[model samples]
Target: MPDGYSRSSRRLSILQCVLFCALTGGLAASGIVYDYSRTQELARQRLEHTTDLIAQWIIGAFHASDYLLRDLSGLVDTEILQHPHPDPQAQRRLTERLIEKKDSLPHAFLVGAFDRNCIVTHTNAIVGFDASERSYCRALRDDPSAEVFVTPAYVNNLDRINVTQARRLESEMGDFRGMVAIGVDLDFFSAWLDRIDVGRAGSVTIVDSAGLLLARKPMLPEELGQRVVEPRFLEAFASEDEFSAIAGPSPIDGVVRLFGIRQVPDLPFVVVVGEASRELFSDWFWRAVVSTGMIVLLWLLSVLFLRNHLLLVRQRSQLVRVAHFDPLTGIFNRRHFEHLADLAFKHARRAAVPLSLLLLDLDHFKPINDQHGHATGDRALLAFVEASLSVLRETDLFSRWGGDEFVILIEGDEADARILAQRLRAAWARIELRNDQGAPLSLTASIGIAGTHPAVPGELDSLEKLLAQADAALYREKQANR
Candidate 1:
């Protein structure tokens, strides 16, 4: 019932609303962080899987090449090598044999064989050029057990980047005869890679086991034969099987890329396939934006719903208070006090316990309002109500009966009612208020008490008779004071 309590309640309600908003925002932020982290992990896994598929495709091409080279090698063993003391006709037969097979081996740009004495046979180029000095010839010569040899990227006699796959030839006595070499134009790989889908700015590369550049899409002539010394490949080299990486500054083009690397089976080569990071994560960007937007919307909805519910509850509480209590003094208003009286009177009549009432009036409330302003008058009324409450028991009903007057219904005898009224008067006398000029103002009240005991009262049989006696006594008290 104090002057500032209602304002304090409003402040508390606002504080609760603020805390609710903060808790909702914090939960939304935590969810977004978790979702984004999960998305990034999934994207990286997708990129790694894509890299593996590209590596496998290139490896499959090499597997096909192996079949072609083996078929040519078999022709040499059965036809020329098995013949003892072979003549020029047999050598010519070997060259004709390669010419026939070359059409079927579409990937091979040139197919040829060289005799043990460094003499060439069945070749498309000049026949007199000794091939024994080439890398493929040395590999077969130095390692008799070597099944195949793969050359690094180099400019062939045709002035194009090419590599070779070779196999050793042996006589029926297992004597070293010569080697069969299949020259492959690496542009075949470039053309194949161009047809495959690897997203925007994606590439496939072939490198020797030494990390030497062999071939790549978006081909660079100056980059051929250069060693790939980037950390990503160096790390991959440590792995014997296929692996992948999200790396920076590609050796071929210096663009950041996601890479997949694997050793070519049964060959001295590695293949690296990659896509640019910008293109690879493009989908993730839109997905992240959409997810964040949904989360924010949900957060806002929760806050709005909570605030609306709280406001509804607050409105209900305010309506209940306004219905039951005096707005200014926060005591029971006349209608609510009368409603409670009907119940209290019925119970009292049944119990036969004595009941009492005190009707009090402020001596000069109207003069105070006229002299000082309505604002100060309102403060004075609030102070008087507070002091009266401090003197009354919880069971007693104190109410604003009308302007500048109040009533207290006591659940006791006449003596108890008089004692409570005296305490209320003394307590109110101590209350202080200030006018607009800030001067202290004092107060007093006149009170009349009535009891249910008919033996001592003029008339007190029913509620109406009891109120009449109280009013009559109050008039007499006012006359005596005048």
Candidate 2:
């Protein structure tokens, strides 16, 4: 009769959805984690390849400068070695050549040759200054195999951060003449690194073998010449020249990143490329949002569809129950009772079994309803049905036939039916109901039997005939009570 699901049915639907949502949420979380991990791995591989290419470019650039420096040193050695000491014009030409080389190699920070006395030419300002005390010059002047020496980053006489690249010049007799040194500005390398894309939070760094910072893409001036003491960096620093990749929190910005390190061969610095953890997984955020949203959306749809199905099932069951049962007393209603009784009549006729029908009517029911209320009459009716059910056998069918009337069908003869009706009458008297004022209300029932033991055949042929007989008996009983 109702359009919506009943209270009990609604509660069952909600409980089912809650359990389903929990399972769906767990599955969605697992899927997101798996996707996140796979995406992160792919990003790392891309970053590693990127860093590799950048490292090669940096190494090539530094190597180009080294080759030029070595070539310049050789040219100088060829000039002064053949002549013992070059003439003034020859030395001037050598100075001119050095100036030309400097102009041709734009990457060179400073290009000028210094003599054994530590005096630099072509610079003009420091032409007569002592050069032997300079660390790079001293190293070349003392070490025999110091064909090429790269100094750690340091502040030069000009107060600029730079690293010295030098190659020793020798005489034809294999005696050391001097060294040709070039100071490379650390900023130049940082600028070159800046040209590439390392993402918003990414970075590239160059540090000497001693762990001293040489250049960094996100140039932190204070970090220049500072030792990298972070455990991850220290670990990379202590690693062999084969170059290894690592992952951890960065010491520079304190952000986590995946790091790839490669050393420039024949150079004193290592190239370290870092891809920030956030940037590497940047795309995964939106992917996870959309993916999780879709999962949740689907789950919600399933719940809605399933709830609709449950509502339909409950509605159907409610309709069937409403069709067959008395709403107030929860007993079989008149129409359904007659249908069941018709089936029972046929079964009993075929089996030739003893069949009994008892029709019951409550006595003085109209006066109680007029005095107390219809609500009390309903309570009395329900109390009678409950008490009768307790006294009836499981095989007996008891049904509410109409207002103030009921019927019972059992597999028994007239005597047995009479005994059952007497028992029900006595029990029904003891059953009581509370009125609105909390006063106890009791009632009695008049019952009539339809079948007598060893009755003639065809006497109770149909349910209608049996019911007519029971109704006559019930009228007689009511008159007797009056």
- Tell me the tens digit of each residue's lDDT in model 2 across 448-473: 88983223554757777778999999
Give the per-residue lDDT of model 1 (tens digit) for 116-207: 75456657765655777888888887777886777866777777667887878877776568877778876656655565566668777777
Total clashes for model 2: 1
Candidate 2 lDDT score relative to the true structure: 0.77
Q: Which 10-residue window in model 1 sums to the lowest lDDT?
A: 77-86
lDDT for 307 (candidate 2): 73
Per-model TM-score on C-alpha atoms: 0.69, 0.71
Error of 1 at 394 (Å): 6.1
